[model samples]
Target: MNEEFVLETKGKNRLIISPNQYCFIKLPSSGIKIVQLRPDGVISLGKFGCFEVNSVLNHPYGETFEIIENKQARAIYTDAFEAGNDDEDLEEENISEAEISSKLLSTDKENKSRLDNRDVNDIGSGVQKLTSVEIELLKKDSELSNKGKGIIEKLIESHTNFNKKTVHSQEKYVKRKQQKFLKVFTIEYLSASNLLRFYTSKDFGKIHELSEESLGLMISLADVRPGGRYLVVDECLGLIVYTMMERMNLQGEIVLIHENEHANLISLKYSDYSEEEIKKFVKTINWLQFFEPDNEKIKFPIKSETEISLLTAQKRSNYYRHKRNAEITNSVIDNVKRGQFDGLIMASTLYLPKLLPKIVDKIGGSRAIVCYSNNKELLNETNHVLLNDVRVINSKILETRVRPYQSIPGKLHPLMTIRSGGGYLLWGLRVIPGDKIKATGRGNKKS
Candidate 1:
C-alpha cells in the first residue's frame, strides 16, 4: 500500500520528461533547481519567470527553451554560452557531440584590440557608478520586482569605462552579466551525477564539494559489481550511497552503517527508487550494531513456543512478527561479522586511525578499501596506518581535479578558476598474509 513511484529511465518514455517525478532544471545562470512536476502544476523559476509544468512535458532533456509571452515556451538556440564548455559535460550528461561543438571554434579568430584597465580596483576608481550599498539595494529591488534584465542593462550603461575595456574583456563582462540576468533554463535528466551537481551548486559544503571524478573513482577502486556485498559509512548526506546504488544497479546489497538512529538518506528520499527495492537493496545497521553484533543477539533468539503458550491468539501473532524481525537482525549481524563483504568504502569525519582497524577485517581478502575525506591530512594518517598493517597494501592518497579551459583553436588555455576541493581518497588493497611480516635492521637500516 505504501509504494513510491520512482521515475524510470529504462522504458520507452525514458527520454521523455514525465510528470510527478523529481526533475532537475538547469537555469541559464548555471543554477539547478529540483521539483516534482504534477500534471497541472505551475513551477516558478524566481526572477526567470514561471511556467506550467504541462507546457514542456514529453520533451527530451538538454534542449534550451525560451520563455515567451503568456507563459509560453519554444525551442531556442543558446549561443551565449557556446564559447567555453567542458568535456565533463559531454560525459556527465547525454548531449550529442554536434550540439556541444557546433560553434566552439567561432571564437578562435585572432586576438582583438582591447582597452587598457588602468583603474580596476576594489575602491570604485570610476569603474562602476553604483556604490556597494547602492548595488545591494539595486539587487534587492530587481529580485523583488522580477526585473533582472533591466537592472543588468542599467548597470552596464552606468559603467563609466565599459567602452575603454578590450573586446575580450567586454565579452567576458557581458557573458558574466548574462549568466546572472538571462531568463532561460534547460531541463536536465536527474542522473545520480547530475543530482550531485544540483546539491553542489546549492551548497558545496553539504556534499563536501564532491567532484564527479572522485565519486566515480571511489566506485572503481572499490570494484563494485553485481551481487557483491559492500560495507559503506557515508557522512556526505547519503550521496555516496546514492551514487553507489546507481552502480549497483539494483543487483548487489549495500549494508549502510548510519551514525544516527535513522539513516541520513535525504538525497535518496526524492529518488525514483521504490520503497520495496530500496529495502531489499540496502540493509542498515547502527554503529553499535556494526561494532558489536554478538551481545544481545549472540544468545538464543526469542523463544516462540514460550511466547505463544502464554499469550492470546492476537498476542501470539504479534510474537511471531517480533520473532521474524529478530531473525533478520541477527542475519545481518552474522553476515557482517563473518567477513563476507566485498569491499570497505567509507566517507566519514570519524578518525580513520582508530576506525580503519575495526572495519578492515569485514572486507574479504584481495578486496579493495577506499576511504575519502575533504581534508588531505585525514587520508595521510590513514595511508600511514594502512602501510604499517601488512594486511592492507598499496596504500596511498590521491586527489582528483577537473580543469576547464577555453576550447577555441590557437587560444586553448586553462580557465581562470578550476574546480577545487573535490576531496582526497586513501586507496589500498586488502591481503591475507600467510606469515607475519618481519625485517632485519642491519647496519644499512630497514629499507
Candidate 2:
C-alpha cells in the first residue's frame, strides 16, 4: 500500500544488477556501502571513484569494477577475486613465489623454509618515492590496463628495498597498496548471509550478536520449508524474518507476533521482496491481539450498505479500504485459533520460562520450537523449565561454533583472531501434556 512498493522490476534476472533495487558495493578499502540504483544516477565511492549506475545495471553480481581517471567504471579482474592473477602480474619481476606465501609471513612457515621476515624491516627500510599527487596522476592515466598492475609495478620499482624483502613480505606490501589505490569495487546480491554480515560489521549488538552460521543452523533445526506455516517472535530487527523468508523462498505463510505496538522491521526494505509477496506471506499481529483476539480485536468503523450509498466516491473508497483491512485482521486471528503451526521460532529478550507455555501450544505436536538469546543462562533456565513440562519434549540448549581458517596454501590453519561469541540456541518439540508416553528415551524407560 506504500509508494515505495512497486509491482514491476527493471529486470527479471535476479543475479544481474537491477535499477532501483538495493545492492551492496564492496569497496577497495574493504568497506561496504548499500546503495539503491536509480536510472541514470551516479554512484560515488568517495576517494576510490564514481560511476554511472546504468553502467552496471545489466551486469551480473560479483564482477569487480575499476574507476578510470575519467570517472568511468570498467569491469576488471582483481587478484583477490581471481586466483593466480597476482602471480601472473608479479611474474615479470621474478618475485612471484606464490600468492599463498603471504599468509605465512607472520608466524606459520619458518619451520619449512629459511626465508622468514626476521630481517625484514618493512616499516622503515623500504621508502616509497611516489607522493600522493603523483599516485593520483598514475590512477588517471588512461594508457594503463585499468587492472591496477601499472600502479603496483610503479610502487615496487620506487621502493628502495624492493629486492631486500622476501617473497612473502613483498606480496603483503603489494597487497596492502592494492587495497588502497585500486579504485575497484564489486556488486553483490545482498542475500540473507550477506545481510547478516553487513549488520555484524556495522552494529553486532543491534542484532544480538547472532552469527550467520548459528542463524543458519537454527533455521535448519526448525525444519523451515516452502509450504509450512510458522510462528515467530523477533527482537533482532527483522533479521530472523528476513532469513526465514529466504528459506521460505516466497512460499507458505509466517505469522510474526510482536511485543511492541508496531513492528520496526526497517531492514526488510532491502530484502527486494515485492509488497505483494510480503503482504501475502508475512502476517503481523500485536502481542495482545494474538493472545486475546476477542478482547483486543482489530477495530474498524461500522457502516451499513445503505449508509455507504449516501457517501461520495472518495468516502466509499476509504470505507472499503478500512473494511478490507479489518476483515484481514479478524481472519488472521481466526486462523491462529485453529493452531497447529508447523513450528515456533523466537529471538526475544523476554522471560522464556513463562512465555513458552503460553505460545508453545500454537505449534503442532512433534513440531520444533527454537529460541535464541545472547546469554546462555536464559536458555539454560528455559531448558530446566521445559524438562518437566509435558507440553514440550526433548528440550535442550544448542550452540554452533564456526571456526574459520586462513585460506592460503601451505599455511592452512585456523586464524588466531576470530569471533568469540555468537550467542546460544534452545530447542524443543511441542507435545500433548495429557498424552501418556510409554517411553521417553533410549532403553524404553516408562514415564
Candidate 3:
C-alpha cells in the first residue's frame, strides 16, 4: 500500500499499532477513553484492571482484550477477540430450568412464595440476594481466573428470581452483569465519525452538538473531496475542516476564513493527521485579510540575508514577522481574486443573512453553498434571503437525525433514549446571473 493508505489503515484493518497514535481504550460498563499510545507504556482502566501498553500495541483495532491479574491466567485471554453472543443459534428447548434456577434460593419459603406470585413485569432489585458490598467483594476476588466471570456466576447464583424471569429477561440480566464484570475492551481507529462521537459524549459544547449524520450530510452537500478547493468558516474549532480533510483523504486545499486573528483548530490536534498533512490541506486567513488585502504593506521588499545579519535581534524578528505575514496575506488575496472556489461551507453562530452575502459571491458558478446552524429559526431566515438572491438557486433547509434501535432478536425495539438534535443544513447552489429582463404592461394596453 501507499504511504497514505498505510497510515489510514494502521488502526483500521491491519493489526499493527504505532507509537504516538491515538486509540480508543473502551471499558466494560464504563465508556470509551481516547488515549495516545507511547512506547513502553501502561494504561489503567480503573476498576476493570491495568494493562501494559505493549500488550495491545501490536494488536489490530476493534479487537477486545481481556485483562487478568495473573501472568499465566492472562495467557488464555492474550488473543484479541471480538465479543458476541450465540443467542441467535440457541433454540428455546436448549435453555434448561436448572441453569436458570442456579441463582434462586428454595430454602426461603416466604421469599420463594413472593417471587412465585410476582408478575414478570414487576421485577425489582429485591430479587437479588447479594448486597452491593458482597458484589464488590466478589469483584475483588474474581480478578484472577476468568477475569470477572466468577463474579458474574456468583451474582447469578445469588439472584433469587433469576429462574422466574422470561428467557429474554434472563438473557438481558446476564448481559448487563457481563458488561459490568467483564474485564475486556475494544480498540478502534480514530475516524471522523469516532471523533465526533468522542467529543459529543465527553463535551457536547465543544462540537456544538453536531452528530455524525449531520456532518455526513454537510460533506455530501458541500461535495467535499480530494483536489477540491473549498471555502470554509468553522466556528466549531476545526471540526468541519477536520471532516473535510478526512473526506479529502488529506489532499486538496481548504481556504479557512476565521473571525479571529488566528484559526482556533484546537480539536485538530486529536486527529491522526500529522502537522505536515494538515498544513498540506488547510490554509487559514482572517476575514480582514481576505476581504481587504493591504496591498501597500504586502508590496514591501524582503531584506537579503546579509542585510538582515547586520540588524539588531528585535529588528530582525520584526522584519521576519512582517515578511511572513505579507507573503501569507498576498497568497490568500491572490487565490481569492483568481477565481471562485469549488464550494462554500459555513458553521458559525453569526447571522446567516449578513455572513452569506459577504462570502456567497466568492463561490464559483455551479458550485454548492452549505451552511450549518443549530437553530432552526436562523436557517429558516437564511433560506428566505437565499430565495431572493439571484446568484443562489434551489435554496432549502434540511434536518437529518439518527434514531438507534436495539438489535437483539425477538426483543428488537427502538432504544428508550437516543441522542437527538443533529442540527440543520441550509443548502443552495451558486449560479451565474443572466441579464435583467422586464415584461411590458400588456394587460393595461388591452384595457
Candidate 4:
C-alpha cells in the first residue's frame, strides 16, 4: 500500500482529469481503455461508459478497479482503447439537444450504490452536488462536438452521484483557480514572480530570477487594460489565455491566430462552469486558425460582388452563406498597420524575423512582446530586425529559472529534460509618441 494511484486510458487522446494532474491507464483486455482519476473519477472512451471510484476510494491505492459485467441486464463495462476512432464519428454525427439533456441526468440505484461504496473521501473530500441549472449549463457547454458531448454524457449517465449540482459545483471550484492569476496548464512546477515575492517575504528561497514566474511577469509588464485588442501567440497551454480572461473586462477579446491544431484555446477544459458556460466563454474569442477550414477561406481582392458570390447553395432552396473578407496572407499585415491592436504578444519556438516585421507593421502604436529560447542566434537576429524598424521603441531580454527549495540535503535524482529555451523573453514597444529633445550639438540624439 503505497500512496501511488492507477489511471485508465480511453479512446480519447487524453482525458483532462485536473489542471496539472493526469494519469494514463492501460487496459489489460481490449484496446479500449479509460483514463482513471487520481482521487476518484474515471472517464471512459469511445462507446465505453465512465464512472467514479468514490465507492472504492477507501480501498488501498494499489487496489485494481474491476469492470465485471453482471449476468442480469443492467449495464455493460469493458476496458478497451480506440485510436480516436470516436473522434471521427463525432465529426460526422450532430448530437441532438434532447440527447444532451437526458445524458446530463444521473444513472440508476445500482450505479448509485456502486458510487457510494467506492472511496468517497478519495473522490474529493470537498465534492458537492450540482444543481439542475448547472447541469443544463454543462450540457450546453459540453456540446463542443459529438465526441466532447459524449464524454460528458457518458460520465453523468454512468455515475449516480454526478448530477447537475455536483457538476456545477466542481466547475466553479476548478475555474476559481483562474481568478488567482496562476497558470493552470503547466505540467512542471514553476515559480512565478508573485509567488516568488511571497516566498521571499516569507524567507523561503534566496532572492534570484524566478524562471517559473514568467507569465505573471509578462502580464505585469504588458499592462493589459480593458477593451484592448491583443495579437498573441503562445503554446503554453492557454495559461496566458486564462490570465487574460481573468484580467480582462467582459468586452475584451483575445484573438488567437495559432498554427497548431491543439493550441491553448482547444486545451481549455473547465470544471467550474457547465459545458454551456464554457462554450459561451469559448465563443467570445476569435480563433483565426491558419490550418483548419471549418469555414470557407476569406478570399482576396475585396470586391462588392464578392460577398454575394461567396454564398453557395446548400440545396435547391437553402444557401450556405459565408463572410467574404480579406485573406490572412493579404490582410494580416494591413490589419496590423491600421492600429487595430492595442498590444502585440508573440511566443513561439520558430524564428520569424522576416515575417515578424510584417506583424509589427500591423501593430501601429502598440507594444511588441516576443518570447524566445536561450539560443542567442535566433533572438539576436530578431533583435537586429527590431532595432532596424523605427516602430520598435525599446527591446530587452529577460531570463527566468526555477530552483528547488527546502529539500533534504543529501537527496539526489537524475536531471529532467525540460523544453528547450528555458523560458527566455524578449519585450518591446513602438518608438514613436515622445517629446523631441533639443540637441546639444555634441552627438546623435538618444532614443
- Top TM-score hit: 2
What is residue 179's positional error in candidate 3, in angstroms? 1.4
Q: Could you give candidate 2's per-residue lDDT for residues 1-447 as a string of tens digits?
A: 122212233233459888887888887567888888897999888867788888888888887776664556777654453212323233334232222233333332233323655754646533878887788888767234444556766876787666667656665576677677666789988777888888888899989999988899789888888677888888888988888877767657788888888876767888777776777777888888888988766678799989999999999999999889898789778767878888998999889988887887788988999999989999998888777667777777888889877565655677788877798999988877542452353223212
State the local distance difference test value for candidate 1: 0.71
Model 1 per-residue lDDT at 181:
61
Encode model 3's per-residue lDDT on 211-236: one tens digit a residue: 88989999999988777888899888
Q: How accurate is candidate 3 locally (lDDT)?
A: 0.70
User: What's the number of clashes in each of the models?
Assistant: 3, 0, 1, 46
lDDT to native, each model = 0.71, 0.74, 0.70, 0.40
By the lDDT metric, which is better: model 1 or model 4? 1
Candidate 1 lDDT over residue span 88-197, tens digit each: 24442443322332222123212332345565443254777867677556666654333355556566667766655655565566556666665567877677788888
TM-scores for every predicted model: 0.76, 0.84, 0.83, 0.41
Specify the poorest-scoring 10-residue window by lDDT in model 3: 72-81
Candidate 1 has a TM-score of 0.76
RMSD of each: 7.3, 6.0, 6.4, 21.1
Judge candidate 2 against the unseen true structure and give its global Cα lDDT, from 0 to 1: 0.74
Error of 4 at 73 (Å): 29
| TM-score for predicted model 4 compared with the true structure | 0.41
